[model samples]
Target: MDKLKKNEKWFWGGVVLIELILFYSSSMTYKQQTSVPFLEKYVHGKPLKSSLSQIHFNYGGKEQSIANDGYYHFVEFFIRKGAHFGTYLILAVFLCLALYTYFKKNHFLNVFVPWLMTTGLAAFDEFHQGLTGGRTPSVTDVILDSAGALTGALIVVIITYFVIRHKNVKKV
Candidate 1:
């Protein structure tokens, strides 16, 4: 009935939506999940070719070289990793908000529980990926996801601290 209760419901809804998205994506094959065709149609250009060509690294036990693998694969690699980071970051934020609303008195649990849940979900996601065709699990991805979760949780913590401090100051 109150504003806090409504906000808590919204935050939990966001978490559920994110989980559904992850589940659907995990169910797809690697080829089905690739955004290469879309990128080639709209994003392919000389500037991308030049910039992406400069990037070379080893990922998933393979060399991601533009010259060897082509520009599309090279660009897709970053896009995929960014998606992983961004999705987990949002999930963490929602988790933090929902937990904070429910457990306002337990500040330690509010942060720790979200990080643990995000990390656990990341690991589970990787395991699910292994089940899909043409997809393999990566521990590195789990670490990256966890890092994103940490960043989001810290952002929430910092903002909450400042907002609460400001309110307390105003009351004096």
Candidate 2:
């Protein structure tokens, strides 16, 4: 009974964490009409500057820089494009983890289940946008979101396989 209670707490805690992540990234998203200079240009494509990019994502060394505004706008575009998708991705991960932990089992279903949860998460995420100030949902975004969920699941499958293999090797 105590273990069950502890499991429930952890499960809910993971869901709460997903909500928090969604809230944060969604908040980071710049609305189309906002006064923020770069983001405004990024959304509407007013052709602000040929050289000026909105996002300055620093990959690593100072030498590597992407100055093309298209890439910046693309990044911004994905942020808007991916809001719902991010929700799906995160929820799927948590659900998969919780199920794996609970059954104390793992398999192909570990990957399958997260994608399943993603379906509901994708819907809720879009619905959330309807309630928010300047956000509108898109079907394309949901597609992208589902893509992200699948991608995450694939990664988990790879990692889980390796982990299980290592465990077996250790037992030998």
Candidate 3:
């Protein structure tokens, strides 16, 4: 096989691996997925807690400020949301890379297809979460995941644009 085919296979493999991770995590109950214990064990200190105590905001119909939920819960909230964002971002990036060659004739399809696939996956993930104990599916999470996917697809599009532009300039 050619180098491009090998790279495409690797990219698709990455997408599969990420999807498996999402599935495994979604299968676990909230109790099983909590990072609080790990944080409490390894990050011993009041400095972070005290400094962030004043920060507060509402999320998922509840107040998530450090003052309302304590430092650990507050921190955990961001960690979980960040994970959602980062995971979808990587998923979309991999999908884009994997689909790029196939959809190269249409730039719009190259970006749109990956974003749509990532969004569909995010929706499915949330639906899976609804079946898990102590876990509630949220539309808000799906939105966040979609946003992350869009960002990742845009990043690939931007990079490709620059690379192609540079090559054209070099040719001239």
TM-score of each: 0.90, 0.60, 0.92
Model 1 residue 152 distance off true place after TM-score fit, in angstroms: 0.9
Off by over 4 Å in 2: 1-12, 21-75, 82-88, 102-106
- Kindly give the number of clashing pairs for every candidate: 0, 1, 1
The local distance difference test score of model 2 is 0.60
TM-score comparison, 2 vs 3, better candidate: 3
What C-alpha lDDT values do all the predictions have?
A: 0.86, 0.60, 0.88
Which residue pairs show collisions in model 3?
56-65
Model 1: lowest-lDDT 10 consecutive positions: 1-10
Residue 89, model 2: lDDT of 64
Give the number of the best model, judged by TM-score: 3
Model 3 whole-model lDDT (C-alpha atoms): 0.88
- Rank all candidate structures by their TM-score, best first, as comma-separated numbers: 3, 1, 2
**Looking at candidate 2, what is the lDDT of residue 97?**
56
TM-score of 1: 0.90
- Kindly list the per-residue Cα lDDT of model 1 for residues 1-172, writing each as its tens digit: 1355569979999999999999899889988999889888888453568777787888667888889788877778889999999999999999998888765666677688999999999999999989998988999899999999988888887778788779889999
Where's the lowest-lDDT run of ten residues in candidate 3? 1-10
